[model samples]
Target: MARRLCGEGLGTMLLLAAIVGSGIMAERLAGGNDALALLGNTLPTGAMLAVLILIFAPVSGAHFNPAVSLCLALRGDFPWRLLIPYTAVQIAGAIAGAWIAHLMFELPVLQLSVTARTGSGQWIAEAVATFGLVLTILGASARRPDAVPFLVGLYIAAAYWFTASTSFANPAVTVARMLSDTFAGIRPIDAPAFIAAQLLGALAGLAASRLLFSPDAKPVAG
Candidate 1:
């Protein structure tokens, strides 16, 4: 349990750092238009998450995202007792990472709001983006643990390109992003709706996983 907790904490911290650091760099490098900037941000996020999962999956099951943890619990992989702690640590890590990025960028650039949003179409985009993410994680990793890291990284990269929401699937990340005034932040007022949509999408992914991956399949030993 201690090992799992530590892995979760470290993974979450790395996740946030990659997000904020890459976002800051992207903004600076991309100038005004953010296309190249987003690529800069997401590519490192995908790579780092893959590395973290590879490094920590044996210890904490590598659930860097609270939503991923919740879904895995529903699938009967994770212990229910660890849920709150895991989520709390993940959120804290995200906040700390954002704070680090703020410090690195020297405050002025960090103070500039970089939160992103889309029109009503974006709500649907968020749903589909999250659904694809959860589904991919479950199919590629939870159900088939051998492929966890690589497949997850590939899925994230694909989701970033295909989804309009840029596939911000984790609620903790959504909340942490709000603290940063940088390109990675989410507006506080808009967060709840995006989070709700992500949860619903996760549920859909769970159902799909149940249908597609047999419950009788052998569980991957942690």
Candidate 2:
């Protein structure tokens, strides 16, 4: 249990660090080119996601996101008893990671984001983004467990471009980003809607996974 929680915390910490740190770095280097900065942020975040999942999945299922953990618990892939602990640690790790990123960039340890990312479209985008992410994780792990890391990475990379909200699919990630006044930050006032959307998407993804990859399906007779 301890090891699993540690894995969750560490994985989430590293994930946020990669996200916030990359955003800061990209903003500095993009030279007013939003596309270029986004591209830079996308590659590292996707790559780090794969690496982090590969490193931690064997130990703790690599659920760096509360949405993933919640969805897995709903799907019965994760033990219900560990859900709260996993979520708590993930949020803590995210906050710590944001602080780390700030320290690294020599910015304030905490700053409320002014970036207004609210509205119906962004909320809808969050729902869709999270649904796809959770679906990919659950679906891939059902048949090709070893492919989960890569599939999640690929899905997020694509979601970054396709989704208007930039795919803040994880509740923990969304909350943490509120403290960062960077290219990746979202306004605190907007987080509740995003989190609500993410939770809804997680439920939708779990339902979809159950329908698409029913665990009770019997094998065909020879």
Candidate 3:
């Protein structure tokens, strides 16, 4: 249990660090308009997620997102005892990661206005983005665990491009990103709506996954 918790904490830390750090670098140090800088940010995020999954999936199932953990629990894959601690740790790790990014950039992230989508259209975008994320995770993990990391990375990358909200799927990430004044932050006022959309999208994804992928399906070994 200790090992699992540690793995969860570490993975969540790495995930948030990648997100907050990249956003800071892109918006603050790089002047926010460079396409290459944006790419630089996304590349590392993908790499980090892949690495974290490879490292921790066996131990903690690599549920760095509270939504994902909750969904898995609802699906009967994870125990109820794990829900609260996993969420708390993930949030703490995200906040710590945001703080680290602030230190790295030597900027006051809290004072900066959040950068995220707003309005009904934006809310729709968030739903679609999160729905894709959750669906991909469920599909890959349920039927093809070996492809989990790659599929997740690919799904996120695609969602970032296709979705207007840029795919801020994880609630912990959405909250942490709001703390930064960089391109990644969402205004606190905008957060609840996005989170609600994400949770609804996750439930939708769960239903979709059940229709598409059966629990008894065999995963191909890499």
Candidate 4:
């Protein structure tokens, strides 16, 4: 149990570091080209997600997102008793990772993002982003357990381009990003709506999965 928690924490931390750190680097190097910066950030983030999931899946199911954990718990693929703890650690890990990224870049460790990312369109985008993420994850795991890591990575990479919100499908990631004032940050004031949308998206995804797969659906591989 302790080891599984550790895996969640470490995996989430590394995931956030990859996201925030790469965003900072991309912003610094993009020479004012937002698209190019996003591209640079997206590639490394997706790559790191695949690597981290592959590394930790065997131990803790590699759920670095609260939305994913919640969805799995609802599906009975994850133990209900561990749901809260998993979410707690993932959030803590995300915050820690954000601070670590700031430290690495010699920026202030404590900062609230000012990048106002509100509005209905953004909220809807988050819902669609998270819905697609969970859907892809569950669908791929049911049919091709061996390919979950690559499938999730690919989905996120594509979502980054297609979604208006740049696919912040993870609640933990959304909260942690509020602490970063970088290219990937979202304003702290707008975090709640994003979180709400993500949770709703999770539920929608779970429903869709249930409708499409059997009650004894193939358990999702980490």
Candidate 5:
């Protein structure tokens, strides 16, 4: 159990480090080109996610996102008793990751984001992003266990381009990004709505997957 927690904490920390660090780097290099910055941010984050998942999956299932952990718990794929501890560690690790990125970049170690990410479209996009993410996880694990890492990585890479909110599908990432005040940051005020949307989307995705992938579901006669 301790080992699992370690994996969760370390993986999430590294994941956020990659996200925030790459965002900072991209912003500096993009010279006001938001698209180029986003591209820079997207590739590193997606690549890191796949790599981290592969590294930590054997140790802790590589659940770097609280929303993913919560969804799996609800589906009976994770232990309910450990949920609180897992979430606490993930949040702590995520915040630490943000601070680590700041330190590496020589920015303020603590911050509250001023970037406002809000509104109906943004909320809807978050829901869709998380919904797809959870569904991708569930489906891939069900049908292609070995492909989970790459599938999730690819899905998030695609979601970054497709979603208006840029797919902040993880509550821990949302909170940590709120503290960065960087290119990847979300305003502190906006984090709650994004978290809410992510949770709702996770549940929706779980329900959808349950129905769609039900072993009891019979083939339709053609």
Candidate 6:
């Protein structure tokens, strides 16, 4: 149990560190070109996600996101008892990671984001992005467990460009980013809606996964 919690904390910490650190670095080097900076942020995050999952999945199932943990619990893949502890550590790890990125970049460590990421469209985008992410996880793990790391990594990388909100699919990531006043930051006022959307998406994804991928479901004939 201790090792599992540690793995979750450490993995989430590294994930946020990579996200915020890359955003800072990308923004500084891109000379105000949003697209270029976004690309810079996208690749490293995706790569680090794959690496982290591969390393930590064996230890704690590598669920760095509260939404993922919750969904897995609902699916009976994770214990209901450990959910709270996992979530607590994940959030703490995310905050620590953000602060670490700030220290590395020499920025204010306790700043709240001023970037406005609001509106119905943005919320819808977040919902869709998270839905796809959760779906990918559930669906892929059903048959191709070995492919989960690569699949998630590639999906996120693509979603970064395609989604308006850049796919802040993880609640921990969203909360942590709200404290950062960087390229990847989202306003604190906007965080609640995003989180709500992500949760809804996660539930929907779980439902879809059950309906489509359940063992009782009939296999399609070629």
Top-scoring candidate (lDDT): 6
| Residue-pair clashes per candidate | 0, 0, 1, 0, 0, 0
Better of 4 and 6 by TM-score: 6
**Every model: Cα RMSD to truth:** 3.9, 2.1, 3.0, 3.3, 1.4, 0.8
lDDT of 4 at 141: 83
Per-residue alpha-carbon lDDT of candidate 6 for residues 102-125, written as tens digits (9 for 90 to 100): 999999899999999999888888
Model 1 accuracy (lDDT, Cα):
0.81
Consecutive 10-residue window with the lowest summed lDDT within model 2: 212-221
Q: Please report, in order, the local distance difference test score of every candidate based on alpha carbons.
A: 0.81, 0.93, 0.81, 0.93, 0.94, 0.94
Please report the candidate that would top TM-score against the real structure. Answer: 6
- Those runs of model 5 whose alpha carbons end farther than 4 Å from true positions after fitting are 217-222
For model 6, state the Cα shift of residue 103 in Å. 1.0
Residue-pair clashes, model 6: 0
Q: Point out where model 2 deviates above 4 Å.
A: 216-222
What TM-score, to 2 decimals, does candidate 4 have?
0.96
Cα displacement (angstroms), candidate 2, residue 123, comes to 0.5
Model 3 RMSD vs true structure: 3.0
| Model 2 TM-score relative to the real fold | 0.96
Colliding pairs, model 5: none
- Across 72-117, the per-residue lDDT of candidate 4 in tens digits comes to 9988899999999999999999999999999999999999999999
lDDT of 2 by residue, 1-222 (tens): 999999999999999999999999999999999999999999999999999999998899899999998887877779999999999999999989988999999999979999999999999999999999988988888788999899999999999999999999999999899999999999999999999999998899988988888888554678
Ranking by lDDT: 6, 5, 4, 2, 3, 1
Q: TM-scores of all models?
A: 0.90, 0.96, 0.90, 0.96, 0.97, 0.98
Model 1 CA lDDT for position 197: 84
